[model samples]
Target: MLTNIFIIAITAEAMSGALAAGRRNMDLFGVALISFITALGGGTVRDMLLGNYPVTWTQHPLYIYLTIGAGLATILLARFIHRLNQIFLVLDSMGLIAFTIIGCNVALKLGYDTPVVIMSGMTTGIFGGILRDIMCNRTPQVLRHELYASVSLVVAVVYLTLMSLGVSHGVNTWGTFFFGLLLRLSAIRWKLSLPVFSYSPGRWGD
Candidate 1:
């Protein structure tokens, strides 16, 4: 269930990013690169960190094909993709929630402790976007005041706690997904932000 949800979310994100690349008038190779990174970059980082051999894409060769197909599809569908900003935001939020849960679950299955799991989950959710943004010449959104990575962190801890308390796997899975999703949506809807530096000059320099 989670797997399928993540697959769809990844597809959406890849397609959205591909469309963005196309809108920027990038070439075919550039479009494909952006789509592939947006889709598989997070899972690739998670697997490498966990020392999972063969990586997710290599293990599931179909993922590569699907990513390419999705990219091409996005190129064809670009004309109708008028709401670029909204699509990117929605797909990114979904991708963050799905990848975070998957990361936490993978860590738990591998017998890692809670702190490790939480960090892994956060990284799994955000690093892909970091990479993509760098490639696309934009600041990474997770690094901003926007409660982005924080959402992944809080939900990961919630998932870990629930699992530790003997909650059913099914319950923990969906609960974390919605928790992360709500955190992101609330942040977006309310324009909520983490406290920023007040820029007291002497505080840092003196």
Candidate 2:
């Protein structure tokens, strides 16, 4: 079940990345590059941070093939993609939540404590999007959009708490996945967001 979600999440992430590249009028290579990063960059970054060596995708090259195929498919389907914007958001939310779960599981396996586990999940959930935005020369949506990182944090916290309370691994994973997905979708539907704080100095107060 988790494996299925992982596959779906990466495919969705890759397609979304291709769409981002398409919006920029990028070429095929650029689309593929962004798609790859958006699908796997988060896990790569997390592994690097923990010095886990040889990253997940490096060992599992089929994941690369899958993401690249998804990216190319997005190009072929670009004409109809706009019609599915809401569907796109739903899939993206799934990917976000799944990525968070994967990150938390990795940190737990590495014997990290709660703080690091939470941070690991957030990093894995958002950093790929962050890297995608940087490469595309735009502000990362996770940094500014509704409840993005907050969703990851919430998922990780609740997941860890449940684990501490002796919830079965399968049950905890499934329960938290739905809970996080609901929170994210609600945030999108209601336009929930963290309050923006903009600060500027008026020429050092003149």
Candidate 3:
């Protein structure tokens, strides 16, 4: 369930971003490249780290086709998509939830320790957006302020702890996803930021 939602949300975000790029007069190749990267970059990294060769989309070619179809559809309907930011925000939120769940799940399946699983989850949830930001010439939020990656890490640890205590997979997955999603949405809506790290001049020199 979480994995499927990740795929769907990513496809939508990729399609929208591709359409936005195209509207700037980019060529088809450029649009496709952006869409493909946005859709699959993080999952690819996660699979690679897990030694899951021939990743999910590669095994299921339809994932590629589905993203392509979404891209084409977005291009056709871009004019109709008022308030594109709203669409992106909702999809992005869903993607965060889904990706974080699947990441921790995969790590757990691989027989990793809980700490490693939590880190894996954080990587899966944030890396693709970091890639997208670099490609689009923006600062990746994962490397910036707020509780973004920290939230993902915390949820993963909590989810893994629950599972270790014999919680059902479904409950553990959905519960963590919702908790992280709601927390992130609230952070965004309220402009809630993580406390900034401050250092004394002497400490900095040391």
User: What is candidate 1's lDDT per residue for 1-206, written digit by digit as tens?
Assistant: 77787778778868866875776788999999888887888889888998866787898888888887898798877777775667667777888888898888788888888888997898788887787787888878678857898899888988888887999989888888888888898898888888876778788895
Q: Which candidate comes out best when scored by TM-score?
A: 2
lDDT of 3 at 123: 74
TM-score, each model?
Answer: 0.88, 0.95, 0.84
Model 2, which residues run further than 4 Å from truth?
203-206
Candidate 2 — what's its lDDT? 0.92
Span of ten consecutive residues with least summed lDDT in model 1: 83-92
Model 3 — TM-score against the truth? 0.84
lDDT values for all models: 0.82, 0.92, 0.75
Give candidates' CA RMSD values in order. Answer: 2.6, 1.4, 3.4
Question: Candidate 1, after superposition: displacement of residue 38 in Å?
Answer: 1.1
Candidate 2 lDDT by residue in tens digits, 1-206: 76787898889889989989988999999999999999899999999997778799999989999999999999999899889889878988988898999899899899998899998999889898999999999999898989999999999999999999999999999999999999999999998999997766885573
Candidate 3 positional error at 195, Å: 3.7
Model 1: how far is 43 from its true place, Å?
0.9
lDDT of 3: 0.75
- lDDT by residue for model 3 (134-175), tens: 777767766675557777777777787888799997888778
